[model samples]
Target: MKIRSFFTAILTALFGIFYLPSANAHALYVFAQYDGQVLSGKSYYSDMAPAAATYFEVFRSGIEEPILTGKTDVLGAFNIAVPDAPNTTLKVVVEGEEGHKVSVVADRTMVSNSSNDNFMLLREDIAHLKDKIYLHDILGGIGYIVGIAGLIAWLNSRKIKQGAK
Candidate 1:
């Protein structure tokens, strides 16, 4: 026991001294848009080796502070809704496993969009409502009840099979 403790202490000290910290450089994304335009944002982590978990962060340019940061949902998209836009840049950053990643995200692709550009209507003033629909709003109370019942039935069937085995 004494020898084991001594060897463990020596190994720990050696590792602490020899382990070099890696500082990977990542580029910031810059976006341009017209003033007074409400912007919708969506981002996902891309380019990582197999068996590695994907992690990312989205932020505004210049200040280096994050506007939104989180794990992606079922759609693998972290969506953000901005109130206004003018000379703003949206940033996307992805890091993997203590930043020792197989693919280094050290570049940017710039895409320009005019905020005043109308999707459908010719005039920009009528851009507020452009074919928008919510799933919850459409489904209503009956839809929710049916969805719950289906989920319960599926779970119970799975549990029953497990028990049979």
Candidate 2:
């Protein structure tokens, strides 16, 4: 009986861990572009909601210090005039509530080659697809846990029956 209770407790804990909503559910996402003069982008959550008033920092590649810092507007949009640094890559980080944060690297060549509107739309679609994949992975993990738990229970039951015989 004691061993059965212990197994039950372990299985319960495993199920709780797998089913509970995690911080990543509201993961932050930021997308930015450098247009030779200004750096602009939007910050959003996994649910497609805008991450308004989030703090942002812009750093040059390979540099620890941030060259510019600001917060997103009510619409989760921000624009910063980048210094005249030709052929430089910049990293933009956006941090939202509850330590949720994301970053994107942008270069002049990359931005100039893509249309901003279309790129932004594509990015949003990609985010949604990633969220779907994450959910499927979680469900798959839960299935594996259940399968292992069932196998353990079956083995324990068989052991008790053999002992009685």
In the range 1-165, model 1's lDDT, one tens digit per residue, is 954885687566446534632322232211212223333222222211122234555556576776654443443323334444456565555444444322222122233475333421242112222222234544465467557767987999899999999
lDDT of 2 by residue, 1-165 (tens): 976896788787656656664523567877777877788888888767889999999999778999999999997988789876865789998889998878889645354555677866676566556544465676787679769878998999999999999
Q: What is the Cα root-mean-square deviation between model 1 and the actual structure?
A: 20.1
Candidate maximizing lDDT? 2
- Those runs of model 2 whose alpha carbons end farther than 4 Å from true positions after fitting are 1-25, 84-87, 107-115, 132-135, 154-165
**24 in model 2: Cα distance from truth in Å?**
9.4
By summed lDDT, the worst window of 10 consecutive residues in model 1 runs over 41-50
Ten contiguous residues with the weakest lDDT in model 2: 17-26
